[model samples]
Target: MDKPKVAADSPAQVELEEGKKYAYCTCGLSETQPFCDGKHMSTDFRPHVFTAEKTETCYFCRCKQTGDAPRCDGSHKKLQEPERKG
Candidate 1:
């Protein structure tokens, strides 16, 4: 499949409930930003299905480039850095 679209150049802080299932957007095409909204249906990508371990605010990756699936690893920070001159 092709590379995912960049939903945003930052993480989405969302409140997750313990024991609740969440479908995080992997394709970066969801209108829901960090959550899945069935936009991946046209692509090979599927939502990252996971259950919240605890009730708390969590940072979810919106750039779709995090090494840690469905979570932010500060990858978005690097993505927005100004390009170096040659």
Candidate 2:
């Protein structure tokens, strides 16, 4: 059996700015990842709200398979790690 794959266009992404609020995407269908692109019209998913207090970047969950919604749970690392060398 093949491992399940997550869509490339998953609703994952996050921006950080001092005292700034952003609307994140959680439907994995948004044209804009981590942002509410109004693509949740056809799905039952809703946009998520996030705030920042510093100029930083955050990893949003693009797989939608994370137990921690709207955040990455090292899932990307699994896909990005290099194969072990002997």
Candidate 3:
């Protein structure tokens, strides 16, 4: 499988509406951050479809490494830490 581009090192804060469906950019090639802009059509990646159960502010992952789709799971923090030098 091809690796996705890194959209951001952190999450994107977005306001979601209840009962609305959103397509998350798994390819990270979208001009729209954290959202699919149909840029993954040529790639092996597919957008993650999610429906909001309630209207609220949510954090979407831009790192493309989260086990949880579309949402931030603090996985980006692992990349933020400085590596220990031997």
> Cα lDDT of all candidates, in order?
0.86, 0.60, 0.85
Q: Per-residue lDDT of 32-86 in model 1, one digit per residue for the tens?
A: 9899999899999999999999999989988888999888998776764542111
Give the alpha carbon lDDT tens digit for every residue of 1-86 in model 3: 48887778889999999999999999988989889999999999999998999999999989887888888998777764442111
Candidate order by TM-score, decreasing, is 1, 3, 2
Model 2, span 7-35: residue lDDT tens: 45233445579888877666666656656
Error of 2 at 40 (Å): 0.5
List candidate 2 segments past 4 Å from native.
1-5, 9-14, 76-86
lDDT of candidate 3 vs native?
0.85
Misplaced by over 4 Å in model 1 are 80-86
Report the number of the highest-TM-score candidate: 1
Off by over 4 Å in 3: 80-86
Per-model TM against the reference: 0.88, 0.64, 0.87
Query: What are the per-model C-alpha RMSD values against the true structure?
Result: 4.2, 7.0, 4.5
